[model samples]
Target: MASSSISNAEANTNQPRETKFEKLTKRGRENQAKEVTKMEKTRWTSDAEQQNYSVKLVEALSQRSHGNSSPAAEVSHVAVRETADRLLAVAAKGRTRWSRSIVMSRLRLKLNPNKHKKQKKPKVAGDMRSKKPVAVAKKIPAVERKVRLLGRLVPGCRKLSFPNLLGEATDYIAALEMQVRAMTVLSGLLTGTESLAPQFDPLGSGRS
Candidate 1:
């Protein structure tokens, strides 16, 4: 009986020490978790800043409209638009870092950053009229400078071009509305706020 009592006391003493060691380990892990969370917050803040910069770049590029400026101004505007488009493409999602780097390289080749000052004439390369006498057209006649309203180039690509700044703003707002609608639908599914019924069930299990 004396030996059994001695053994019981030793066991009780060892168990408490083990418990204390475990508690210390758990506290260490909690501290590490806090450190990781702080680092993630910093990383997220940096990403947000980059995204905001990209958005501002897009807005700056969109300011180049036909009606607002002369053909000479349009040349400079095209340069800015092209450069901004390059940056926007870099900011595009679902692309590898290497691929984005390649795109940036190509853009750098195409966009002459030093060519910022307004040039002599418009840079677009489409013949508006069939054929013209070289000497007669040496002095480019002043044509109607009205920008095409709501210009759409292809199917499934809405708001492809806009006449002015207001139209561009409207296009962005419309895009935001679409995103909000998509988020609403997704939130409904994620939160179980809306029931999603099965349209057809071969096994007769109606639960979706």
Candidate 2:
């Protein structure tokens, strides 16, 4: 019984001890899904953390652009894209909403020097076309058509039939007559064509 127990103890010592944390190994294909799940929970919860991540992302991209290239070699677009994606993935911290395309778009926007620069508003074709007399003449027919339509729609406008419209016309005529009388008097004074009215005497005679 003692000899059998010694052999069993040796067998147990040789056997690998299974532990709970051993399931979390990076190389284990079985733990990949679990690892991904755990990583998905990680995120930059604060502005400072996010800012730091952004700085690292920028540095990584810069290195990929400038430092990784050999003197004779041009950096490939695919390589640049891959580098940007890797950095962005790290910055993303397994955020589900940040897909690969979104991350790349954001990365490009952030890195581009001219992203925030305001683009000049494009000039319209009409703006470039000069407002010549010919163009003005061409537009007159349209304006006349609109005015004729308005005249047809407006009451008494077609034949000046409304009393209110007639009154308005008379008022306008009266105003023009008053302006003509004032101008005639002024011209008469200037040309010495007429004597000053008694009311126009400025030596206190007009008041008396």
Query: How do the residues 15-132 of candidate 1 rate in per-residue lDDT, one tens digit apiece?
Result: 7454788899999999999996575345312434344433455354445444355654543645654554444444433132322543655556669765545667665678657567
Cα error of candidate 2 at position 202, Å: 82
Model 1 regions more than 4 Å off: 1-54, 58-81, 89-95, 98-104, 111-208
What lDDT score is found at residue 148 in candidate 2? 57
TM-score of each: 0.20, 0.21
Local distance difference test, per candidate?
0.45, 0.49
What candidate 2 gets wrong by more than 4 Å, as runs, is 1-50, 66-69, 72-74, 95-208
What is residue 35's positional error in candidate 2, in angstroms? Answer: 22
lDDT of 1: 0.45
